[model samples]
Target: MSLFRLDASILPGTSSSAELADLVEAEWTAAHPGAPVTRRHLGTNPLPSDAWPLAHTGNLTPEPERTPAQREAMALAGTLVAELEAAEAVLLAVPLYNFGVSQHFKAWVDLIIAGAPVGSPVLKDKPTILTTVRGGGYAPGTPREGWDHSTPYLRRILADVWQGDLVIVERELTLAGVSPAMAHLKDLADDLHAKALDAAREAGRQLAAK
Candidate 1:
């Protein structure tokens, strides 16, 4: 089985989501031995911000009339889509940025939609894992209960739009230990971290079974 792992953390070295994803990938490799794992680290090497717009316009224009940049953008979109199409499973490590999807992730999603036919389910029932980490708790009744805008968007794209058999592993209060203001929640954060790790391993096992 082949795995396609995409990371969208601007700070890879310190990303909680990446840490969980590492656990997921580790479990996957343990299950599949020598299976190939393709990686795309959008944080370090992001798609051009202008690519999606160019691709969108290119698709609307006649082939002969498309500019070079448009053609390149279209080709890039095709490649991104091709990666997902070729993978047997997917692992996306996406951390919330300012309560919403990271800019890099949003760009990738836009380009993916632009590359594929309209209303296409890119994942189409393939096994997929999304490990999303947040710096604060947003559970019901919390001060930020309705402030988290990232998770729902992620679900809408990966599960609803792409139609993947998705499983999400989320960890909140990730900054409890690091931020003085959240220090009091450190114990809870540690517990959540442990649980998220366990969930990640479980998700990995599920992906391997696929």
Candidate 2:
């Protein structure tokens, strides 16, 4: 079985997404030995953050070749598509930024969610897990909540790509300096890690069975 881990954290060295990937990969590898894993860290070593313009262009003309940056951006896009095509399970850790996924993460999605195949997309029918970490909690029914664009957008996008089941684990109000009403950040992080491991194990078992 093949698993693709796409980490979209702008922070260097210590991103919540990276942490989840580490935990998920460890659990999956322990459960499914010899399974191949392809990890792509987009935030730290991004290919290029200019996919918006290229993807939106109406004309298919060569457009004067491309600058170095454009070329890298296209290559990254191709790499992402190829990875998606080969993987059976995908784990996307998208920490919330300003109530939504970071622009870098969105750029990666733009490259993969092509507007073809009304029902079956490259990501079509693949199981995907989306994990988010925030300084505060945004669980449904909680006060100061109800505006979670992270998983909602991902659900729609994943539906278009793989048409697969999308799972989300959200960690909110985990940072310091928020109203005492919010949960402790450390405790939330701990709990989130545990839940993420469980989800990863299940994901591995499910994918292996398939």
Candidate 3:
């Protein structure tokens, strides 16, 4: 079995988002020994600034010398999109940035979603499991959840690309400190991680069984 993990943490530390992804990977590997895994860290390799212009304009092949930066940018985006297209299941570790996915994550999404039709998406039928880490609670239906564009935005994107299934694991109120409040949230996060691990393992098993 093969699984693709996308890490979108911009911070260069032991962030909760990174930990969640690691747990998912570790659980998957333990459940299905010998399975192949590919982890892509978007923050470490940011897309070229010119990539924004070329990609936004619907052009994949940009000039080499004239646009040296965009050359690699377009290539990286294309390669990542191709990998997503080839994968059976995708595990995304997303951290909310101003109520939505990180800019790095948005960059990857821009590349993949650009390939899909304006209204009808091509990547729509693949299952994706997303885990989000935030400084506070933003679950839907909650008071402040409306301010959360994280899951909603992701859900919309998945719908546009081609929807197979969507699962969310949210870790909220992370900045509240190590007091009882934060501890409660951490426990919630742990539970969410466990559920995410289960979903990921099941998705892998389903893909492998096929």
- How many backbone clashes does every candidate have? 0, 12, 5
Model 3, 101-139: lDDT tens digits are 777777777766554445445446666667677777767
Go through the candidates in order and give each one's C-alpha lDDT.
Answer: 0.95, 0.66, 0.66
User: Against the correct fold, how does model 2 do in TM-score?
Assistant: 0.76
Per-residue lDDT of model 1, residues 68-177, tens digit only: 99999999999999999999999999999999998889999999999999999999999999999999999999999988899999999999999999999999999898
Q: Rank the candidates by TM-score, best first.
A: 1, 2, 3
Who wins the TM-score comparison? 1
lDDT of 2 by residue, 1-210 (tens): 788888878884767656655665666677678988888877777645556466444224375856655555555556677888888888787787787777888877776653232344776667776666776567767664766677677777776546766666555554544356544456665676577666656654554555
Off by over 4 Å in 2: 62-75, 114-120, 176-197
Q: Residue 60 of candidate 1: its Cα lDDT?
A: 98
- Give the C-alpha lDDT of model 3: 0.66
Model 3 segments more than 4 A misplaced: 58-72, 115-122, 139-143, 178-210
Candidate 3 similarity to native, TM-score: 0.73
Q: Model 1: clashing residue pairs?
A: none
